[model samples]
Target chain A: MEGIGIWGVPLAIFAGAIRVSTPFIFVSLGESITERSGRINLGLEGTLVFGAMTAYAVAVMSNSPWLGVLAAMATGAVFGLIHGFICKFPKVNDIAIGIAMMQFGLGLAFFLGKPFIQPVAPHLPSIALGGWSSSPQIQSALNINVLFIIGALLAVALWWAFKNTRVGLILRVVGDSSDAARAMGLNPDTVRLLATAVGGSLAAVGGAYLSLFYPGSWNEGISSGQGLMAVALVIFARWNPIGCFLAALLFGGAGALGPALQSVGVTQGYYLFYAAPYVLTLVILVVTSSPTRSLAGAPGALSITK
Target chain B: MTIEANIPTLPPLSAQSGNLRPILEWLARRAEPVAISLGAILTGLALFSIFITVVGKSPIDLFKLMYTGGFGSWFSIQNSLSRAAPLLLTALCVALPARLGLVIIGGEGAVVLGGVAAAAAALPLTGSVSPIIVLVVMAIAGMIMGGIWIGMVGVLRHYRGVNETIASLLMAYIAIALMNHFIEGPLRDPASLNKPSTTPLPAEYMLGSIPGMDVNWGLVIGILACIVSWILIEATSFGFAARIAGGNVRAAQIQGLPVGRLIVGFTALAGSFAGLAGMVEVAAVQGSANASLAAGYGYTGILVAFLARHNPLAIIPVAILLGGIDASGGLIQRRMGLPDATVLVLQGTLFVVILFCETFYGRFKIFNPDLWKRTA
Candidate 1:
């Protein structure tokens, strides 16, 4: 910002967007998969926090970042399993339960996570995406993390499976109409339970990314509703996995705006910048949630849709 | 597809005992919820005890300490009651809109914004206005801001088809951001360098304790608000319209009720109550606005609201019970070397189990008096 002229603003915002979108991509995709199975787990925020704590703790203890990821995944799966079982009961409101589970998860994490706050865990390595650039600034800007690629790949895979696979067909059938699934001699509850577990593990991976890579440590302040935003991202993406990936990147970009500006030497009113991704999400929700056109890929049984 | 081919038709009820419905129906309605609540609490405690044992603690000692620490003595009872004051209003925030079938869980945003608004409004009249007038103005400003915030969510849900749950949450994030901006910049009391809070109201001007009690007047105000809400929901036409809409939205529309207005009105009223909680926190407890204003009360109120089945009158006792648990956290921490979050874990566990137990309400034949004949 000192000598780079007026172009710095947009460039900084673009850079910030990439950095911030990482967690969003992971969590949103996880939510997309769970929601596709007819159960909405609102507690992913807690999962994200707990995942970060587990990853950080494991990394510190074993000196292996990959092991941390695995540990986090296991932790997330257990959380998901609890949610699935509780929701399977008759007349239970999954959304309210999700909120309760979130609080429970956060409490447990805070109770146990107090010990791992100060350690330097093994961090994930990044690739130089901007290697072609000669300038140091450009080279640094191009250093993209590995998790982003993995997130994108997962989204594509989920999209394809959702379209062509029998398992995906069953999930959609269960999500669309449980009575229809019942008629087909399938248990809707079992499918949803498995889906929630899978979704929980994926969301934990997102949490692993937060602690093992970006923001790069476990602490109480690590996540600020990236888990909850994933739910909104699913709606914007119309519950398409691939769309969730792109939407997450967009959210990440919004999240990065303030920090990018701060890094480039414009630190005025940084709090306003922090509100960017949430504001963007609200705007997108209002715009996309119109009564006029049919939401092209919406699941028939979704409660959010009128 | 296979099950569709088979059916066993059953006839409707026409028994002698069913014919004498009024007296039995009244008794069953009163007993079912209490029985379910007790059953759920026992199951929750058993599950939680397992967790405590795994962590190398005795559940019996924990319960004993929690009870004594929270409500064993007169002093502890007052302490628990003090905590219950804010909860009462926050619980109302969720309870009110729930009647209209909208789940508004973003009351923390209203509480924070309302507190900030109250402090900001009072800043100008710091020395000139009478303390009573200033407090009234603070409450009004806080309530108005809160009402408008949630009311907007309700409007968006009705007119634009936006999901109120997400919209309200997003709005809450925005409100917090705004509070941070104002508190850290424009509203920051230069003298409060350590904590970066708004200027504190002088002690003389601050809200004092109620006569014969250590707690402030917030408790009375919150209880009065609950009573008024109960009257509105149970004894008025507006409440009736909201209830009808909650029961069958499409049918309510067919009946020519202004569904949009009721939705927005109920949510707005709910937000106002949450905002009033913030105001009371400002005027009664903190005597100024700070980060403490967003203390997870709003989220906890969601649990309280659901646990009470969104019943306005039922919220009072439930709020106090939860409050006692919260207040006991400090004592348990000191006595058992447990983490402060133990109470939070207990609350969360209880909430999850209770909600899951909603499935059991009419399932058992003995509990359902109409189905009792089948057992005989």
Candidate 2:
């Protein structure tokens, strides 16, 4: 703690936020897409963990981090497909089924992941944003991973496409009112299913980022609740892709608060800091649920609205 | 077959047509849930078997080990019963709330906090108070802690319109952090250095086993609690009001039922049951509060409650059955080269399949007495 200057704290925190926000950005953007299409997949947390395991195993075995990312995307799509198909059934509660799927997904991952915990995996490379800086701390803080840029670009692309494309209108119409889509003879279920698959794939890419990039390893403890937090993050973001990107960064910042403090000679009550993101999530939910004003851009058919 | 032969024949359907038809239909309707639940169980078994086959493992061997490890012998049965004890209370934690249409999954939080509170209470009373009095006080403290925790969720749902499911889950996560804080910081026992735990209760003060059985007294208490819960839900006005409220909020409010009170009361009672589960784990098993208090019982209770169709009496058997499956996990891992999480996979699969089968409740007419042709 002695050699660190006053600026070290803020700089390290910024770097930590970028490193941590990568997963949240992917997951929240994925959720925002799904919610925009009038469906919600609460099982993405499971998908994320499973994706992490799949990516870690693939990267470890084949020494191809890129292949690991693809494998994770495929696995996530399969999970999303199952969630979509089951939710299409009459009388089935999607929320309850989401929880069950989360459990099942986690179980299957742990069962299959038992042997891959110890192995090292191929890591994603980082680009230094502060190559001109003289201090190692400054350079480290500026070193951004590839996923961060990709996530930012994805958010921009999605925000643009959702407003400009024909498919976006169909999705919005379906989400706003299934009856209107039915009147237009469009299959609401099909649109929702496709949206969910795409969302699941993106979330898996986030998981791949966890395993093959930051913290680069295959282990059971790689994820905590980053996947679950994305649900809250999407809500905080008001269902906008760009909003998801910023919200993810904020959540990532909060997530790193504890570790960052520890790094800066504040080690007591580490558990309290570990709880910051959840607390932030809970507060956001409470605020959003208040009756004073409607959530700015809530999908009309979203069941979460009271 | 001999048992059926020895039984007296029931009267023919047509013999008492006018008076008996409604009664028979009523009975048949009452039987609907059990039939559907059984169908779901069968479906789950089929799915599980398919999974085993795909993995190149013999389902029969797995089933054999599950049964043998769960109930074949006296020791195994006792072990299963011990596991079932906390599950009974935890399942009730979910079941009681379902009567009021609340899906409260934060029983894990209540259990963890309850155990911590109970231990915290017991520490000061160890010297001056009689062990029995201290234990009773601890139980009360445990129940109070749990009740307040979940009751808060119910209150939020009633007044603030918070979703109980998510709220309770968030609370559970928070409760775990709180427990970890206490165990690692304030309540750390000096002797137990590596694993943080509260000071252990004296041996005499700890809960004992039931006479003539190796099972602890917690099993009896759990069974009794279920029976009492069954009576409360089935035979009380409060239960009736809660059910009405659960069916339709607008209708209940129109009928002048205090929906808010019912919601809060039911959730509080549910929390107490879960809290008691934590106390039992402490007093009977662990004899102290530790990180193990969050052991997946709270989550398992959700499956048990659903499997029982939220029936308190039915939860007893379902919890016992799940307990048996849980007891066999180690055997599956050792003998079949399966991961420890194999049991979790089975449980998760069963849960999802059963919930899916819930849609089939009234689809079959053969099971409905009203659809039965005249059997002269």
Candidate 3:
């Protein structure tokens, strides 16, 4: 604390932003994909928590973190499938079902995760990008996890595929108008279901990142509403995968603000500072939301926008 | 006299003929919700039993212990009642707004803030004011704070078109953070080292039990609140308007109903109930505002309201029933070697199944009077 100079706070925040934003990146991107399909999955919070538990438990049992991640993705896909199938029924509210699914997922996780709380599972490996740096602080700060890089690449890939692929065209059509999709001889239910499954798997990977990498551990309190927040993040991102990535970073930076300030001996009201991300999100929503009009880039079939 | 005799007067109808059809029709109308909910609960229980068996536990023994712990004895019943007290008010937090088709799940935020506000308001009056006055002030403070906290969600939903569910939840997180900040910093009681609680109310200032019963006044207050809410929703024009709005917002607006006001007003009223529950907890249970204020009662209230189908009167029975299940957790944990989360699992299962059963409503021809008329 004594030897570190004026650059300490900025450096800490930059590193913290990267570390915290990784999960957000994955989740927001996942939610972006789901919402783009004209459906919203608020149950992602439950999925994320359940995924964390599954990852941790599997890691402990199989002695392999990768296997644990795969298990989490599989469970998450199943949860997504349930949500998609249930919501496919006429007069069924997606948002309400999402809340119910969230509770179910959380309950299931807590019930099974009680046993995995104590055991130490292997952590995901990191690539030390700061090896070239002479200062130990810089080196430590630059040790980025592998999932962040993968998530970034996935965002780019999704952006590219949405513009160039036939599957992307079908997804866009199904999301924008189910009636149109039917006219085009496509099954909107199946398309949305598959999209939601993919989204859920992606969100689970985000949870895996949490338990296997940064702040890495298997615990009931691991999520703190990150999965839910990602929904709002996707809104702020305006349904674009690249925008989702940026918004996640912004949220991540806000999330890291308190720790960065505390690192520099600014401890007063730190708990309030911990709420920066939520406050920022709420403020953004308020500013962007219009009572008379739907959001600019919202999908036509999205119930939440309506 | 001859003209009067020519005017035929039929004999008075029998009592059975006068009342039977209406009663039958009422029963027919109510049969769907009751039957569906019962079926859902049974299915949930069966699923839970299967899970228990898979985990190597005997479901029969667990059920026996649950009953014994929840209601088998006078002591257990009292415990269940005490637990149900907060639930009644919190369930109203969800139930009231639900009438207007708004889902406000942030009652937990209101409860925490309300508890903190009550404690803060009580700090200056310690030993200087009448206990009853202090209690009244605390209740008002709690209600005001909680109402404002949740009213913002309603306002946002109507005015800004923000999603109420997401906004309310995010606000809940913020409220918790605020409570933690204040409790640990500005409001920290010097004597409280580990838990970081506010100053405790004196024993005499604390709420007392009924003359002969062990349960505190919170139980009575909760029951009274439920009755009052029931009257508000059932016997008032305001409730009628809200119900109309819930059924179809466009029609409500076309009828010139103040939809925005109704949303804000109902949400505020609901928040006040949750706030009152917080005050009751501070006065009757914890005696101070702390992290313990978030005992998950607010979230459980959502389940209770849903289980009751968002009817204020129905909430009473559902809250008590769930309270019994919650009260049985410790007994099950101790006797059957099951984790405390087993109750949560059961609750989650019940919530999911009940919601899924919502699709069953109005689907049966027997429940529809129009269909009955066609058949007749």
Best by lDDT: 3
Tell me how each candidate scores on DockQ against the true complex: 0.58, 0.50, 0.57
Worst 10 residues of 2 chain A by lDDT: A287-296
Candidate 2 docking band: medium
Write the residue-wise lDDT of candidate 2 on B101-210 in tens digits.
88877799999999999999899999888888988988899999999999988987887777677778778888888888788778878788788899998898888899
Candidate 1 Cα outliers beyond 4 Å, as residue runs:
A1-15, A128-140, A180-185, A263-267, A290-296, B1-25, B374-376
How far out, in Å, is residue B61 in model 3?
1.4
Q: List, residue by residue over A1-306, the lDDT tens digit for candidate 1.
A: 345566566766666666667778888887887888878899998888888889889999999998998999999999999999988887888889999999888888877887788879999788888888666656666677788778888889999999999999999998888899999999989989988888888888888888898889888879878887777788878899888887787776666676667776765587786777678778878877764543446776655554
**Can you list the residue pairs that collide in candidate 1?**
A17-A253, A20-A252, A21-A252, A183-B1, A184-B1
Q: Compose the digit string of candidate 1's lDDT tens values, residues B1-376.
A: 1232233543444566556655766778788899999999999899989999999999999999999988999888999999998888888988888888888888888888889989988889869989998888998999998898888888888888777888888888888888887887788888987777899988877777999999999999888998999999999999999999998998999999999999989989899988888888988898888888878788888988899999988899999899899899999989999988899789888998999989998876555654443211
Predicted structure with the largest DockQ when compared to the true one: 1
Instruction: Judging by TM-score, tell me the better candidate of 1 and 3.
Output: 3
Which candidate has the top score in TM-score?
3
Full-model lDDT, candidate 1: 0.84
Candidate 2, residue B141: lDDT: 90
lDDT of 2 by residue, A1-306 (tens): 335577677777788899999999998888888888888787888889899989889888898888899999999999888888888877776766777777888888888899998788879888988989777888888889988999999999999888999988888888788899999999989988988888888889889999888887766677767886676778778788998998888877766777777777875577676566666666766665653443447787766654
The complex in candidate 3 yields a DockQ of 0.57
lDDT of each: 0.84, 0.84, 0.86
What value does the lDDT take at residue A33 in candidate 2?
A: 83
Each prediction's TM-score versus the true structure: 0.91, 0.91, 0.93
